[model samples]
Target: MAMTEPTIVPESSAVSVSVSGAVVGGLRDVPTTTLADLLGRARVMDVVVRPLWQPVPRVAGPAFTVRCPPGDNLMLHAAVHRAAPGAVIVVESGDLDFALAGGNVCAVAQRRGVAAIVADGLIRDLAEVREAGFPVFARGVIPIPGAKSAVTPLNRRVRCAGAEVDAGDVVVADEEGVVVVPAARAEETLTAARARLAQEAAQSLDDWEKAHRNRIDALLHAGGHEES
Candidate 1:
């Protein structure tokens, strides 16, 4: 969980990058499968909050990240306006309190072609978020409202999901958990993650067979004793 200083993300690089919503689209994707294979190599803490949001229809691009202050969403709106089509917005709401973003904001993101929203704070209006099929992940849910003063700065480096997220960082989240790949290191990390997944998938198949055999053996042994 090492955090480095915030780095500036240029709007142009993000805007022109090919939209690759399938960046880590399915559990079968290289980086995703690699994460699954590594198992303990990834800590769930690295994924902030409850994994309970409904799946939003995905579009495409790398991820765009932003850090916001607690209970204030000025920067969040800014992030939405500037976010690239395939970008996922990651917000670090200090202390994990307050409802920083909700349905109306999600609607805005949807219109802007944003892919997903991840907040360390609560989000309200589940129905609207779900209805729009906008993917959202947060610490929990609350009925609270947030102030809109644009107090926090946009596109700064901040910590979320036990990892540091700066603008242009790659964020991939699924039912398993979320992982951050620093922009500078994503290409290498993705290659590594895919390798780990292939090795792990083979191991998983072997383990499942072994466990099944053990269960059958125990059942047979108990039947023999009862018959005798």
Candidate 2:
């Protein structure tokens, strides 16, 4: 029996639409916590995919989702070229045995103006990635390289870090974690997040104490505790 080479799918096969730059730019400063709060803490990605370095601020942009088999990075390679300048490449690799990205890919993605990368898989070439100053959040690091034989689809809805991400969805990642805001709800979500942030910023210690005291008093009163 002879082995057959895998077919490389054209970039057009993947469904992706460039999100408006204004929309993506508006979310540049929106914190992941704010987005999480807007979503009721439901759309945040798992904590496993953490930033490779500390003190790195936030990265926000439209998502360019990639669904690929573990140990294969062909789809990711394709996505890097197809993604919009400010898009964040989100990869859903099932396992961590193989490193799906490394220094070379980071350099290419950086030169291409990719906002960042968030993968539910391992990556290698930490030194190079760090030197390139590309923001990457992933499960962990591994020395083993991945195969490029499989050509996975790009820009489709995919589950990454236990969260479902769709192409054009707003991805906001910070020191805390990553959160997704559905494209359809970006405007309203942004409004709500801004309001919430303002409210939190204006809240004083006295206000917090009063709110906590009121809650505790209500609980005690409901339990029939009488004050002397």
Candidate 3:
């Protein structure tokens, strides 16, 4: 039998996401916590991947997916240029010891209008990035930079942190966490999330407490627990 090589995503693959602007925009201001409630725990990224800096702005956009095997970060670096303006660069990184990118990489990405960088691994130069106000969500920071020799696919399905992200998936992240709305469900998810936000906004704290208490009591009763 002959072996076939895996297809490498084109160099220009960063401009690849096809999610509608309306859907992406609708999700932009939606909190990741709310989206997690709607999408369930499975759609949430692992807690390890969090905003690298405090007071970081929330970022939401169509995902430009990239996969970089451990110890190398070629694809992520390449993605900085290829991703569309306002696109969120989502990286599936296998390297933890090496920093995927540093201040310069982030600066260039920001300059190019890339909305943000979401890496399932470490980054470096946090002070510089924070000073520049570039939003980055990652595991942590490492001073050692990763090599750029390994080549991998871009704009493809990627397992980022604990979530499965595909090209065009709507990724919304904030201090709460990162939530991926599957590309196919972007429009409907936005609709439902907005509705939930409206409902929450309309409810008073007392009303919310009353409803919450009732729901908890019903669950407790079902579990055969009695309130004393």
| Runs of candidate 2 exceeding 4 Å displacement | 1-6, 11-19, 216-228
The lDDT values for all models are 0.63, 0.83, 0.88
Tens digit per residue, CA lDDT, model 3, 108-175: 99999999999999999999999999999999999999887777767878999989998888899999
**How far off is residue 152 in model 2, in Å?**
2.0
**Model 3 lDDT on a 0 to 1 scale:** 0.88
Please identify model 3 stretches exceeding 4 Å from their true place.
1-17
Give lDDT for model 1: 0.63
Clashes of each: 8, 0, 1
Please report, as a residue range, the 10-residue window in candidate 3 with the lowest summed lDDT.
Answer: 8-17
- For all predicted structures, in order, the TM-scores are 0.69, 0.88, 0.91
Model 2, range 53-122, lDDT digits (tens) per residue? 7766699888888877977887887788778788889999966788888889888998999999999998
lDDT score of residue 90 within candidate 2: 95
Candidate 1, residues 7-120: lDDT per residue as tens digits? 333443432223233444532254433543443333233545545555432222355656667777666767788886767888887535567777888999988887788777
